[model samples]
Target: MRDWWRDLTDLVLPAECGGCGRPRTVLCARCRAALGGTGPCRVRPAPEPAGLPPVHAAARYADEVRATLLAHKERGALALSGPLGEALSGAVRAGLATVRAPGAGGGSVLLVPVPSARRAVRARGHDPVRRIAYAAAGELRRAGVPAHVLPALRQRRDVADQSELDARQRLANLAGALTVAPGCGRLLSAGRVVLVDDLMTTGASLAEAARAVRARSWADSPVRGAGSSISGPASVYGGETRERRGEQRNGPAQQWAGRRSGRPPVTAGADSADGVVDGMCAAVVAASPDAFEISRN
Candidate 1:
């Protein structure tokens, strides 16, 4: 009801540019360009966390981009999701270009949003990442990249507020805090999976998300579940898993039929019998400028 009312009010109320505060416009032409950035580029945080997937970001989180994200995420500017989604789509496409194998086509792309805490959703009256993900999916479809928003990951424990935490601390706070909800692991095999989020700072959130997906894939594997491999816990980044490298392989999870924050909130996969997670790349609307620098360096 709160989300419905907010959506209704957004249509009727006079609006201002989310990035620039220009009256009567949800977003201005200039700000939209800023939001999209110079085209998506790979970004990596300094001291990138272990298990973190390769990530692409549309824009640097600064100036108009920062203001626009805060306006939509914190201030309920629901209309801004459209522009944000478009920006995210570009990043997703960039990620696909880098990770996808040649001639690997046909399956729809899955935009698995990083789940928000229930408390945050109640406080904000909506799930911002999921909403933007839906919009991003629509944009991808229109552009001929069959896509769907899949909400499969969830937080298993409370986490400290990330505003004050640096990279290492943020990582420790989120480690082992997320898991793939039951039954969704099967769907992860249905297509290419790209983690989506609004922003990336330390990369801890994405790393943790990658970890959870890898863990779930192992559990879903009939061979692994049967303890057939018996080597060790599946490594998400190890060469053993095709999903980690963006290739899909048939595995226990696939036999049944599937495929598959923020802080600056750490809000922020597929399978084979070996429990290889599919497409371990991530896309975000923005990332800390320093992360982009780290990528270049």
Candidate 2:
């Protein structure tokens, strides 16, 4: 298989720091620090676009971080996933904190990665976002919190590449492009869903994905039995629900729907039997400098 061959090749290939040209290791310590520094920060592109979710980026896309992301995403530096995931885990935690709030239930965090285009997956030979999501989940579990990766979101229709478009154009291209997978509605009804991506550019993609998820959660479908109080369309997978904020011992319970002053209000749906219908936050492994700044040029 192609993956089998690629794995075998990686094991035998000479390793070098993906960020710098340093030899003998896939990533050197200094570069690793660069990738992990300052933890995560809230990132919003300048001239913020409509429907954009509050994104937490692990590091500013600069210097070694930029090189490392390109190496893994474009040059097939598969070994970089570990470090990249480590970096992204911080962002995931930050996003969760913002949404869940202090004293909120940490019960179980479900990471839902934004689906990559089939064409892009075929070209890359692997699904980078999913891989990183898995890594991030692993990191979370190791830290004692329950976590899982959910590839429940998918592209419903084909869209043009976003790289060439401006904010408005990008939003138009991604509009109606994503949907929850066949059974994801039930899964989401049961547990918390956090959209995960490798990078946040204009944030149009995350916003669209979140919108699709919200739509499916509200569809008047049959409710299936999952452990969670909220049930939705029947699914083979059982339901799960987030613990009440007051029930948690880790501090104050956080509400995902609260809007920070100066930030646009978070768009959410009417409350259902399950609970509040607030949308999930987005977590990115890294972001380009342009990610925080919209080009006015």
Candidate 3:
């Protein structure tokens, strides 16, 4: 009922620009341009965190882009999810195109979001990244892309707040801190896995999220209830061939049909059969400026 009221109230109230607090506008034209004026492009963090998948960001995190994300994430400006999500959707498309094989149909994409710490979520009143991912997934599906929001990873242990941590320290702090929710490996192997986040800094969180996806290579085969042969985007890296990769894709997961009943706040992705998760990609609404400079080389 609370969610219903929130929805109805938003319909009746005059919305404000989430980016600049402009009255009677959800997002001013200037703010919308900041979402992805140049469109989505590849980005790479320096000293790229290990296991970090190839990533694309819709816009560079600067000026209006930075301010927009701050307003939405820290100030609970829920309406900004629309524009921000459209940017992320564009980035997801670019990321898929970067790794797509010739003659491919661009199979369904399962957007797996990096999980937020429970305490931080409580303080923020919502999971910011996950919210954007869901909005992004909705944008893709509306555009005829088979995209679904699957938040499959969770924090395995508590870590200190990242506000003061250096890149190296953040990486170490997040190392071994994420894991796939049990019984979702079959789901992971069923589609192209795209990790989605609202922003990327040191890339540490995404790297750790990738590590959790890799760990699912060891998951027990899917239980009979949710049985379905896997189909996924081929990874060109790690030298894993289609036929060799196909053999391992046939079986994954434990009991997705039975075990996961908690809605989409749970679920996950990545193609890690045969001990290699390739062709994996990451997408974000925006990335740090240094990432753009690094991608050029």
Candidate 4:
């Protein structure tokens, strides 16, 4: 009832810009530009986590972007989902472009949103990430990309609030905290999976989410042993290994690694033959400003 009433009120009320409280508009044009003006780019936390997927973000979480995100997340500015989703869609496209390769299946895209804790959801009366994901799927579809929202991840255990936690502590708190919901693995296999989040800070949550997805996916598959064939985006070609391809030119693996470390951007390709590779990319609307720094390493 709270969410329903909020929706009704939003329709009847004189709106203010979520970003800067401008009168008579839900979002001013200037603030809207701030959300995704510069376009999406690769971002990485300073100390990237092991197994963290390559991530793309639409904007730095600062100034108007920060205020706008908080308004939608904490203050029930539900209408902001549209613009937020638009930003996320840009990031999604950017991430997809980097990982897709030749022979990659152009099937439907699955956006698996990082789940909030049950308590948080109850307090907020809406799932912010999931809400934004649906809007993002709409944006993708309008752009001629088939997309779907797949709420496949869930919190399997309680975690401490991340606001006060340092990077190491945040990681430790989220370790083993997430799991794939039962009966979702088969659906996950149906399309390319891209993890979506509203914001990524230390990247602890995304790392844990990736770990859970990989664990469940590998466990459910019948093919696991050494003889089992495994393929990755840009890692396989006609009768050639990634090493051979790398020797010939900078291949997909190099692009994937380089993107995660904020190295110079390189073109890569997306693949769908393998769930492992299909799930190794993520997108977000915003991230810390420092995350956009180019790493010299």
Candidate 5:
């Protein structure tokens, strides 16, 4: 009922720019340019996390971009999903270009979003990341790329709020909080999986998610009902699994180790059969973080 009323109200409300509150438009032209310009760029938190995948951000988390994202995410400015998805699609494309090798087989690309806690979803009345991922997939398909969203990742343990933590603290707090959904290993193994998130700060959340996904082992031979094969070291703090396997194999473990040591992580695209490209892709509509900040003056 609340959702229905909100939708009806939005339909009747006077137009206003979501970024700067300009009248007569949902997203004004100037703001739209600010949000979408410059193409996608690589972004790394000041202090990167361990084992984090290479990450690409469409825009810096500041200015008009920040405003637009917050408006859509926190205030339920649902109409902005189109532009946001478009922005994210660019990031996905950029991220894919970074990791894919020349002539690699392009299989289907699976976008696995980092799940929000139930409490957060209940408070917001929606799951923002999942919604954005769906929108992003649509954008990808329109560009002749086959993509799908898999909501098969979830928090396996409770975690404290992350708003106040530094990179290291954030890592410790989120270390074992994620797990693949039941029966999701096969889905992950079926194609390349790219972890997607709306915003990344410390990157602890994404790193932990990658770790959890990597840790779950896939049975060498397919099993009828073995329930996903679960092997590998479990974290002492949380009993979450940590290793994974499939018909497709990972690059030498050393390759990941060196990559992890060098810089913040970003998605790497994989090549598909018939010369289709697959790998991790990320996209965002805006890059400015300051746009969302409230001015005191």
Candidate 6:
């Protein structure tokens, strides 16, 4: 097979860095540092989309970072997944730190990936986002940080190609396009959910994924003998939010709007109950450099 031969030859052939033409290395030191060397930072898209979850990213998607992501995602550079995954794990950890204090023992963090449409998956020959997520989970576990990948979110319907859409049109196209597989609520309740992606441009996709996860009811869903009732969730994010029966709850769209992280607080005593916040938390490996600029709106 063509694919089989390429894999076999790569093992014996001299390799080149995916990001740069550095010889004899899958990724060079310079390129590696470009991935996430300065630690993860919060990134907000210019003219942020509605319903977008607050997200952190490891590095700016430019130069080496941009090339590395494309190589792994589009070129079948499977060897690059390790470094890419490390970048994503840092973003995930930074996002988690926002909701939980450092050194606080708590529920596991679920790494839920946004699923590609079936048609896209077939054309690519691999699911790049999910693959990176799996590697990221492994990186977290190795460092004693509890995490796992769950492809719980999927396309509930087809969507128009996002390439030609503007920010507003992209948001409209992805609205209501995703849903969680039935019976996964119990698993979601066991820990926090952090949506992971390789890259986030307009953030329309992430917002829709969050809606599908939080819009459905979990109390009535069965998971063996385990179940929980956390009241009416107006907004559940990386941290705790409280709501009671008949009370209006602001969703993630409103809740994440006002917060910016200099030093994120881990909200442990914020709630004693064990449950995933109805709102969502999100992170990505890399984002456009301009995304970090704080807007005054």
User: Per-model C-alpha lDDT, please?
Assistant: 0.74, 0.67, 0.69, 0.74, 0.61, 0.68
* Model 6 lDDT per residue over 1-297, tens place: 544564566677887898897999989999999897588887766555444556888988899998999888778777788889999999998777655421235678789998887887777667888989999999999999889888888787899888788766776687668877887765665566788888888777776676556544333445421232212221223232222222233333333422443222122212224522233478899887777655111
Candidate 2, residues 45-158: lDDT per residue as tens digits? 644433444577888778888898888877778888889988888888876654532124534678889998999989988888888888888998898757899898888789
lDDT of 1 by residue, 1-297 (tens): 888898999999999999999999999999999988889998877665555666889999999999999999999999999999999999998877654431345377888898877888889989999999999999999999988988999998999889999765776687678888888886765666688999999877887777676666556767642321111223332321222233343222211222221010111122245633234578999999988876731
Q: Give the true-structure RMSD of model 4.
A: 8.6
The clash number for model 4 is 6
lDDT at position 126, candidate 4: 98
lDDT of 3 by residue, 77-175 (tens): 677788898999999998776443212554578899998899988777778888899899899999999999888898889988997987667766886
- Which of the two, 3 or 5, has more TM-score? 3
lDDT of 4 by residue, 1-297 (tens): 998999898889999999999988888999999998588988877566545677889999999999999999999999899999999999999877755432355567889999998999999999999999999999999999898999999898888899999766776687768888999866766666688999999877876676666656555666631111112211111111122113233222322443455432221222345422334578999999888874211
lDDT for predicted candidate 5 compared with the true structure: 0.61
Q: Which of candidates 4 and 6 reaches a greater lDDT? A: 4
Off by over 4 Å in 1: 101-106, 224-278
CA shift of 185, model 2, Å: 0.7
lDDT of 5 by residue, 1-297 (tens): 655676676678876788888987778887787766676666544444434555666666667778888888889876677777777777777766654432346566677888888898888777778878888889999998788888878898888899887655776787668888888866765555667888876566676776666544222225421222121222212211112222222222332443445422222222345533333333334423432221111
Global lDDT for candidate 6? 0.68
Comparing 3 and 6 by lDDT, which wins?
Answer: 3
**TM-score of every candidate:** 0.81, 0.77, 0.77, 0.81, 0.73, 0.76
User: Which wins on lDDT, candidate 4 or candidate 5?
Assistant: 4
Measured on C-alpha atoms, candidate 4 has an lDDT of 0.74
Q: What is candidate 1's local distance difference test score?
A: 0.74
Candidate 4 or 3, higher lDDT: 4
